[model samples]
Target: MSQQQTTLHVELGDRRYPIYVGASLLSASNLIAGAIKGRQVVVVTNETIAPLYLDTVLRQLPDTMLVTSVILPDGEQYKTWQTLGDLFDQVLAARHNRSTTFIALGGGVVGDITGFAAACYQRGVDFIQIPTTLLAQVDSSVGGKTAVNHPLGKNMIGAFYQPTAVVIDTSTLATLGEREYAAGLAEVVKYGLIYDPEFHRWICANRDLLAARDVDTLRHAIQRSCEIKAEVVAADERESGLRAILNLGHTFGHAIETHMGYGSWLHGEAVAAGMVMAVRLSAMRGSVDVDLVVELEQLLVDLGLPVWAPQDMTSATFIDLMALDKKVIDGQMRFVLLNALGSAVVVDDVTEAELTALIDG
Candidate 1:
């Protein structure tokens, strides 16, 4: 491990794992090798990422360890059963066993599918997350909520499998396009809105630094976001209770992703708009002040995130798509709403009329 690396533990009793956050972590071969559980390894990545970092990762593995690579076509549209089957094909063709470790070497799409593949392949296997994008580094890569998108809904098919470790290299953010980088700021803003108001304020204060990709600012943001998610996942690994708070904007966001088609609006972009919708709903229900909604919207806007659902999407369409969301319980849609700034709760009491009004108006 590098001296500058920040390590946070996701405490899940025996399933606990360390999240390493810092710069140049991709070069830490010992750190990468230490997390693997067996002699055989398969590094799962996408075509877009393989050309950039696959060789670097392969070189990190011990010479004695058998390492193979599976590179899938890049995009959210590719995150499906067919793509997952491709991963399985590679593993089966290589004759890998349960002891084989799967290393995810791209962003959230790569991490989610790879982790889900690890969860189902031969019942289960160990996996490592080397999240290269800001969105994955701050949120998706740390949580272990792995899955692929279904045409009807997002993450409807998935598991609660945990990773052996998460290695985040801030240097990777340098390669990200302007839009992708902005999308990540949405998830970073989520931790602040739902759990730490102070963190939210800090992000508001550091917008320029964050946009500029300042290393110190990103390291702190990634570490804090991981810390918040680690604590939540430790308490509720399966989204039974407290963990649902982490999905503050996801319910509506997933609906957008499903309705618009995956890869259309980035996950974080959809979530940013979804969060604005949630905040608007909260204000309509008298759960929070309208000023709070305005404040949150402005923050997201300042960070280059969309605060409105797409103009083409109807309220009824949102309702239809959201009904298929994973948060639905006993046929009732459960929404994560803010009780106040820095606090959130899941409620099933929201009426269809209320949601329709919120979406339409």
Candidate 2:
């Protein structure tokens, strides 16, 4: 039998595009070629991903279009200005012009840096996201917030540029390492925790199936996640207001990434630990019940995600690092905390004393 397919649209008016979700989408030449705006195409992917799926993607492009490939070293640590510069060198060496369309063909790191490259290249160019990992398919690939990480904070330098299309081939997940696959679940759980209480319950009930990578379950999770994220982006493309809630565990998570050094912990693993901290802080602030904290932590643990912050880091260190977060405004650190199981809010009123106590405990 043939596999199913799903499509969602990001309503950005003139900048709107479609997100195609299905199995074997990499084989769909028409879907990929139709999204390209020009005859010149550059595919930017990481070393780990290149050997696995690059040729398949290349096969999908129209023969008439000129194509070039840049294979970057795979890792969160490589999401830097230097690596981005390397990508630019390849584009320039190939003589790719402003009309070139760049294709990001890896996970979140590749998607972010590639999209950022497209945004800055010749003032701006078109790009498509062909995200392989579940994390990228559901979260990073849908949102146009692209950036390279800084030593001080994650995603400190970037742009709010949307993509021409997001092609998600679920079959690619089969190539993901177990740890990476589990890491992606952190973002999946985030959607449930922040906006869909029922989805949270669904995740809890289907934990085993999801961990096993059941196709139907994986498809539903990815589809729903894209739907929720697309809706949020449509309402606030630049994260001016409502979109901030999407940063649920990111403040703490970004701190962990910076302090631990990027790549030490997978983005989703750091986010899993960070979500626990956010929930605990919410409880301390009297916004949520302690039981809710335990529940969320249990869920993360069951999913093979870490629920504790790194033991080596002190509370003060976390506070200092978090001050560098992109969400900080006017010297106040903004946090996205849950007030209930499914509702999240962004607030900058978290006092140092409260944060210190929570981190210390």
Candidate 3:
């Protein structure tokens, strides 16, 4: 963008891509054009975001580019095999080829589904991440972690497909409702908690500015989160080792999502609550301090994020679903627990007895 932007590059071998974060990124067509390897475009969005941001994004594409649009139903409940399969059906019917570029034009669900479709289509095709929500900008869009939920587990079926480029328009946050904005902030808070204590403290200090979508504060938050995520994804793109640490609160969070049913709670809301549970669990194990748990909870509370699982879910159900989580390997459940703020460890050594107490409490 001629507006003079600070560009971030994700170096992933031959699949390297650039992430541009600034104002009017979608309206800036050359930046978008620079990312795509070929001309054909398949813009996948949903009913909710279509009327709002789709056209503005499409306006950026050149008249020579053939753009096909697909707007699916809105909500996480629809992030399924059936939902994702529709993109394949639509694209394949149109005879989309290896050169076809899929553009994810909504929030996480759209990004995950579109990226997964990109991974599988023609044995793999190029896709762009145009993450509209704050959560997507900070977490989903940058990383290549793509997936569709299974009735049995969250992200049970998916692929790791990097985007050709990620275009994040900070302006979109204005339309996000308070609850939805808060949900996205949960991920932002996560980046701070898991990796950068300095960023965590910055978030704490700038809570008001962030809540108000102050550009300078928001830009810093988004950029730092992407930097942390890009480094992790580079080291362990498939999440075999170091990358799993990114799932700090996800193990418990995914369980709540499964038992409650998807979309009932926004993913970030569930993660915020889940992180609180993990901290509490860690403290009860006699390792983590109680004060840290409370402080973390307070930060989330300040952001208007949920700090507890839904009252409707039975602990027994929560446990059962967690057992089936993708993190479970070698007949043991692996959890990413904090050693302290801004650092985490994936421990598989916690006993069944200890786990039961954590969930029961």
For candidate 2, write residues 1-361 as lDDT tens digits. 1268888999999999999999889985478888987999999998999999999989888889889999999898899999999889889999999999999999999999999999999999999999999899989999899999877678889999999999999999998998899999999999998999999999999999999999999999999999999999999999999899899889999888888888999999989999999999989888889998898888888889999989987789888888878889989999999998889999889888887798876
**Poorly placed runs, candidate 1 (over 4 Å):** 1-3
Q: lDDT of all the models against the reference?
A: 0.90, 0.91, 0.86
TM-score of 1: 0.97
Q: What is the lDDT of candidate 2?
A: 0.91
User: Considering lDDT, where higher is better, how would the candidates rank from best to worst?
Assistant: 2, 1, 3
> Where is the poorest 10-residue window by lDDT in model 1?
22-31
lDDT string for model 3 (267-315, tens) is: 8998999888777877876667899888888889888999988776656
* lDDT for 93 (candidate 1): 94
**Whole-model lDDT for model 3 versus the true structure?**
0.86
Name every residue pair that clashes in candidate 1. Answer: none
lDDT of 1 by residue, 242-302 (tens): 9999888888898887778889899999999999999889889898899988988888887
Residue 168, candidate 1: how far off, in angstroms?
Answer: 0.8
Q: Could you tell me how far off, in angstroms, the CA of residue 124 lies in candidate 2 after the best superposition?
A: 1.0
Considering only N, C-alpha and C atoms within 3 Å, which residue pairs clash in candidate 2? Answer: none
